[model samples]
Target: MKIATKKIAACAILALATGLFYQESARAAIPIQQWKASNGAQVYLVESHAIPMVDVQIDFDAGGRRDPADKAGLASVTAAQASSGVAARGAEPGLDENALGEAWADLGASFGGSAGSDRMSFGLRSLSEPGLLAKAAQLAARQLGEPAFPEAMWLRDRERMAASIRQANTRPSTLAGRAYAAAVYGSHPYGFEVTEATLARISVNDMKALHRSLVEPCRAKISIVGDVTRAQAQTLVNTLLSRLRLTVPARCAPLPPVAEVAPLAAADLRNIPFESAQAHVLMGQPGYKRTDPDFFALTVGNYILGGGGFVSRLSSEVREKRGLSYSVYSYFSPGLHAGAFTVGLQTRPDQARQAVEVVRQVIQTFVAGGPTDAELQAAKDNLIGGFALRIDSNRKLLDNVANIAWNKLPLDYLDSWTQQVEKVTVADIKAAFRAKLQPEKMVTVILGATP
Candidate 1:
């Protein structure tokens, strides 16, 4: 049986790797279907019969932002431990972590859970053959609703995580990140760090309680991509969420609102001394939320500013013209709330100040005048040309669908993405950047830099 399972798994993997399952061209228009599930879950599907496999992502409102400040990392550890084991249900026997792994392997499918800053997600991938998909969905539902949160397993994983945190603390990058987050986010939950003490505070009961309260069917947004019809996808979603034990009220209760990431009040600078030869510098401020109207403008503008790699103005100014650093980049991490807009680079400790000054000047100039006509044209052309790569595979399409579902974006968002990028004019970029970024109030963190 084991040998047979190994062969099946290998064949499934090979099929996926060789793109044998996908038949559609990358540039085809994606027709998205959206509906409300019987259990109040929002379901989004893109029926692609070209592939005989399915990719799914289920997202909930439970994530790091939901964690209590006193017990940071609760959502993360809860998500991790959900797959540790599943409790027995009547006639079915309980499965430990190892048993769970074996079961998924035998079916040539995979399911796992993770939590990011704004949402907790469970993802599953499997061949859509009737028997295989049924077994995979059932197993996933069981794991989702019946996690044991074994005390022994939690204790073991906690120790391992604590040790990893200790090792990370010794690195300059970690230290810089921690300081930068604290400086930028202030009292926001987004800045909460997972310390050894915080890990020690997380008990199995906490995981169970959090999972019980937040992982409700009503709060789920299910995104599916692959070779399944609407009826089949509906059934698959129902089965995948069947194990959730909580009864849904006629109307789901509103969760307590998390405070937004606050805008910086003043420029804050931290110069930490370390023994490293290269200095790490990070500077930024709260940008904007995913739902902001200026998203496309900000995105296109960021590309010209620093997100376009060596072609970006920041790179041209900081790396090529002055030769202060080999690389320098900036990005906007917009989420449910205003995420950070950061510029980062590494340079010789002695040259750190010069690099920092150059990056600052470049940003100030760009924010004031916006990109030139030529730069704006180039950014739009590059972004539009490369859009196909975003949805080239099942996994990537699933991610994009999930983003749409979570952010409440339009159903035609993916299809109209290039149009949005193309329509972003120099005036739009300038107005958006001027409204969102405040260079004078940005937070700066420099580690291993000389005074």
Candidate 2:
């Protein structure tokens, strides 16, 4: 996901200039109301009377990471079907899966689902009118519990995914991303993509079996935010969750522990057989999880390194100094286990190697001598001051809360994040990098380049 830096920089500068800004001081602690439904489903509720809408997200432990070895796309295929209309013929009848999605989108009631490495998420957003809420909640429940992955629908989606994989072969950006994931994760499930072979291999029975095994109430977390009271939230949770039978599956196996391997001395080059003028270069190594202690430090440090555009070392070096690319960035994608820490940029095919070298050098310089006190302070100030903006809206709060729930983070994490960032001294920054990011161990992939 790309960071919209134009708004970020404008806000960050204002935050930096203001020596002391205390938005949260007067605001009471973000009250997180929690309860268990009769069906053993845990519900997390945050009542925000600020907006006249409600957003509900239900997450199950059944994500794509658990897709069986033989049926690599089963989990994702199942997830997509879940948001499509149910097989039941009720007030909404004869609406096929794809039609249901389009219909919901047309009606202004947003519904969708994604299968990530660790969990499957199904959510709905709509106005909080009691009628709308009830309809939305009922629709969500039906989709969650009774999706029929019709042969026609399955074939269409599978064909689409397969086409994407084929197209990816010719896309340099896609090539670099795929290589980077494979290099960092090796043969781990996280490295696997939705291939035509995988899609063709997935049967309807595979999706049904996976759904039966994984989408259980006990292994789920529910988040309700916006114009909903405790009672309204409880009703919604119970209505949707009570139908779900709570049967916890056996715990997933732990990630095969991965250690950084030596970096490539010669760049790994792939010919996607495309004629794009720009080359996509992605470089980095294994990343940390969400709850890692060094998260706050790495977050702020990365901002200066590349996460903060225009103000970042990468932007200065790659764009301002040499005009190698329009934009460049480095980011840590935190997942259930370790995600990727990737630095990516698109430059003319001729200049891709130079751009990669610049990124590597910048990282090396930081590893040897961490960010200056001034840079560290700027990051800290920006993070702390901008905390309010992050949580200003109910949707934003729901996202943060969902992340906390999915990652099993402390309830008061947002409250404590600022303090942790403030405590990250330069020594701490250096130490964190030394432990987590290895400059020499990063695997570099330059796509759309000559061998």
Judged by lDDT, which candidate is best? Answer: 1
Find the 10 residues in a row with the least total lDDT in model 2. 1-10
lDDT (Cα) of model 1 = 0.90
Against the reference, the lDDT scores of all candidates come to 0.90, 0.74
Residue 116, candidate 1: how far off, in angstroms? 0.5
Q: Can you tell me which runs of candidate 1 are displaced by over 4 Å?
A: 1-25
Model 1: per-residue Cα lDDT over 375-410, one tens digit each: 999998999888867776778788899999999999
Give the CA lDDT, 0 to 100, for residue 296 in model 1: 98
Clashing pairs in 2: none
